[model samples]
Target: MKHPYTKLLANIIAYAASIILYALNAGGSINGLTILSITLATIASINLVRAITTITERKQQ
Candidate 1:
């Protein structure tokens, strides 16, 4: 339960950083930064979803 909360916090931080990087990339031409940021954001969002699901399951149990 506590670890889930920590994971959620980490996911939030990662997601936020990725979004910031993405925004910065958007202003510029296509490059590795844009690709990397997008990829990281996607991964972070997925992890966030998983963390939320785990939390929910634990609560149900």
Candidate 2:
């Protein structure tokens, strides 16, 4: 079962990662946006992992 939102999830992960890197490089303070971006990236990563697992399971079955 292929997930329809895979591209969206990838984009979200990329966006969050870029935001985190930009913040780190800019020598800015740790604010809400930074925290939010980290959280979003983590969640997106987890979802992507789950999607992969599900696809593999389906293939095996």
Using lDDT, give the best candidate's number.
2
Sliding window of 10 residues with minimal summed lDDT for model 2: 1-10
Relative to the unseen true structure, what is the C-alpha lDDT of residue 49 in candidate 1, on a scale of 0 to 100? 75
Against the true structure, candidate 1 has what lDDT? 0.72
Candidates' RMSD to native: 5.4, 5.4
Model 1 clash pairs are none
How far is 17's C-alpha from truth in model 1 (Å)?
16
lDDT of 2 by residue, 1-61 (tens): 5666678677767877787888888866778877886887788778877887688679879
* Best model per TM-score: 2
Residues 4-35, candidate 1: write the lDDT tens digits. Answer: 46666776777777676667776765467776
Model 1 CA deviation exceeding 4 Å by range = 1-29
lDDT (Cα) of model 2: 0.77
